[model samples]
Target: MLKIVVLVSGGGTNLQAVIDGVKDGTISNTEIAGVISNNKNAYALERAKENGIPELCVSPKDYDSRELFNEKFLEAVDSFEPDLIVLAGFLVVIPAAMIEKYRNRMINIHPSLIPSFCGKGYYGLKVHEAALSRGVKVVGATVHFVDEGTDTGPIILQKAVEVEAGDTPKILQRRVMEQAEWKILPRAIDLIANGKVTVRDNRTIIAE
Candidate 1:
């Protein structure tokens, strides 16, 4: 089985999608080794528990310094011996050492089509806000390999959603999540777990 550890910081809608995918065999030959959250009260933890998957909270607030938090956080994730790390809605800035260790084995679901409303300061509803401010007609989601730089990773999959009139940031966010994020994130995990994905020259090549 491909053991995966999921990281989240919120309600875990994206995390739930993975769980559903695994249960339905959409993501074959994979098991969730654990779910780790930075927020102690994150609903994602409860989701993991209800599903009988191991869950943990490693918050930076509990540590004296960022370095200490980073070290302990990495240690906690390493304990699960995960083959793949999935950042579903994880908000914490990943430590460089952890990123280096996991490299292409780690992937994240960003709220927008990268290189547009992506990179630093673009997450959650902020991405939608930017797209609306720019008056773009199409907005979407992206799944990519995690790298040292912020959201500057090899793109795995992207799905675009139409931007409707009178759409607020929150409205657009929901649409993107429903129409794109929830779908592609699990698909990307399935692709990686089934050995249908490859990273070369900072891009992903999907196998036939």
Candidate 2:
């Protein structure tokens, strides 16, 4: 079985989706070895504990520098010896060192289609607000390999959500979260697990 490690920093709705997917055989060949978070109070940690998954909080605030924090975080995650790392809603900017070590082994789900409205300072509800403000007809989510750059990794999958005329950031976000985010994330993970997806020349290729 593929050993999986999930990282989260907020409510664990997406994390729940992954757990359910694995339980139901939608995502095969994986066992969630651990769940890590930067916030001790993050609700995702509670979910992990409830499910009997090992949980850890390696807060960046406890460290003197980003590099030090990254080292500690890497140590915590490496303890699991995970085959894959899933970022459910983790908010921190992971250092390049960890990115290099994991490379295609790490994956992240972003709120926007990416390369468009993604990077430092663009996260959570802020991404949705930016899309809505831009009057984008289509807004959606992306699951991609985690590279050194922000959301610039090879895209594994993308699902679009239509923006309604009267939609607020909250409303649009909820719609996309349910219709797009929840569905595509597990599928992306499954693809990686099953060897149906590959990153070649920084592009994701889905095999038949």
Candidate 3:
């Protein structure tokens, strides 16, 4: 079984999707070893507890300094000995050392199609708001490797969702999450766990 550690900072809707996928056998041969969060009050931790998955909180506020927090966070993640790390709506910026160590072993779900309404300051509902302001007819989500730069990693899977007429940011956010993010994030993890995904020269090549 592939052991995975999921990182989250919010309600963990994406994390719940992965859990459901595993239970339904959509993501076969995988075990969610643990769930980590920066917020102790995050509902994701409660989800993990309810599911009997190991959970930890490594909040920056708990540490005396940023460096200390990073170290503790890394230690917390390593304790699970995860084969894969899933960033499912995790808000913390990953430490460079951890990214270098994990490399392609870590993946994240982004709220936008990427290369547009992505990168810095473009997370959560902000991404959808930007797409609406740009008047783009299409909005979507991306599953990508976590690189040193924000949302600049090799793409693994993308699903486009149409921006319907008179859609507000909140409405579009829900649509994109349901149509795109919820599906592809688990699919990407399944592909990776099954050895069907490969990264080459900063690009992803999925096998049949």
TM-scores of the models, in the given order? 0.98, 0.97, 0.99
lDDT of 2 by residue, 23-119 (tens): 9999888889999999989999998888898998999999998889989999998999998999999988887787888989999999988787898
Q: Candidate 3: how large is its RMSD?
A: 0.6
Error in Å for residue 149 of model 3: 0.5
lDDT for each residue of candidate 1 in 1-208, tens digit (9 for 90 to 100): 8899999999999999999999999888899999999999999999999999999999999999999999999999999999999999899999999999998999999988888989888888888889999999998999999998988999999999999989999999999999999899889988888899999999999996
Candidate 3: regions farther than 4 A off: none
Candidate 3 per-residue C-alpha lDDT over 24-138 given as tens digits, one digit per residue, 9 for 90 to 100:
9998889999999999999999999999999989999988999999998999999999999999999999999899989999999998888889998999988988899999999
Superior by TM-score: candidate 2 or candidate 3: 3
TM-score of 3: 0.99
How far residue 94's Cα lies from its native spot in candidate 2, in Å, is 0.9
Clash count per candidate? 0, 0, 0
The models' CA-based lDDT, in order, is 0.94, 0.90, 0.94
Model 1 clash pairs? none
Count clashing pairs, candidate 1: 0
